[model samples]
Target: MSLLVDTANRDTLHTLLLKLTADTKPLWGKMTPQQMIEHLIENVQYTNGTLIPICRRSPEEALEAKQRGLNPDVQIPKNLFLGDLPAEYAYLNLPASVTRLMADLELFDRYFKTNAMAIHGGFGPMDYNEWIIWHSKHFTHHFRQFGLIEGDI
Candidate 1:
């Protein structure tokens, strides 16, 4: 699939996201549909440095993760074990969450234009192209998890 940096792919992603509703169920994992949307939005926020998490992986580990993640052939492992969300974790209504995600993705396009990059918790620092691949894989991973799209994006 083309990266979200591409207009067509962005449109495709948005179109698929609109299909998700409160009743949608994941093919795997614990997140509700809204939680999934919020998760994606938060990831973009992280990419934009709006929500920075402490780096959990060392530089070498981060690099390894980046390399593996950027590989188009590699899918994110199921039940990958990223720890658990806070007990108080909250989610917006589904539509609102999707809208925010769309807006945040647009911001992602704008973000890289002026800034150099941001540190990914697992991928270390990433530039525009690298972010493209990372975010594309991420979206694909969750979309697949939720059974939003079959196979790959």
Candidate 2:
């Protein structure tokens, strides 16, 4: 499976990053901007070793998640807030969603630098390269949903 890497993916992610505001809404999804920010934070946490979901609730669950028959399309998590907060995010204590978004992005950059390879399953254990690609692609996908253009960083 290909992960989104390359200049275009980075540029696109950067472009969309600039367009986000406290009021920015998903053009076709359920998350409020704050909720979306929280969702992304969770994703980063999972990428780092700090958070691990029960990817193997049973032997069957592991097998099902790992089955090659499954489509490669990235899954947009549902009821993302249903889970517990990552401690880092919960400790931030910020009321402004936009501020929290910026904080999350900063945390992501730091984490990406040191731990992109520390994988948790989207499909399975991904190396740093795979994680980076997935991160860029997912960010671009969301930004596009908001009708933003991918552009130079």
- The list of candidate 1 runs beyond 4 A from truth reads 1-8, 86-91
lDDT by residue (1-153, candidate 2, tens digit) is 333323234445444556666576667666554555566666766765557644434555544554432334644343334455344444243245445444555555566677544545535555565555566556545554555643222
All candidates: TM-score: 0.86, 0.55
Which residue pairs does candidate 1 place in steric collision?
none
Minimal lDDT window, size 10, model 2: 1-10
- Tell me the deviation in Å of residue 97 in model 1: 0.3
The local lDDT score (0 to 100) that residue 119 gets in candidate 1 is 80
- Provide C-alpha RMSD values for all models, in order: 2.7, 6.4
Instruction: Give candidate 2's TM-score.
Output: 0.55
Q: Pick the candidate with the highest lDDT.
A: 1
C-alpha lDDT score of every prediction, in listed order: 0.78, 0.51
Report residue 63 deviation for candidate 1 (angstroms): 1.5
Pairs in steric clash, model 2: none
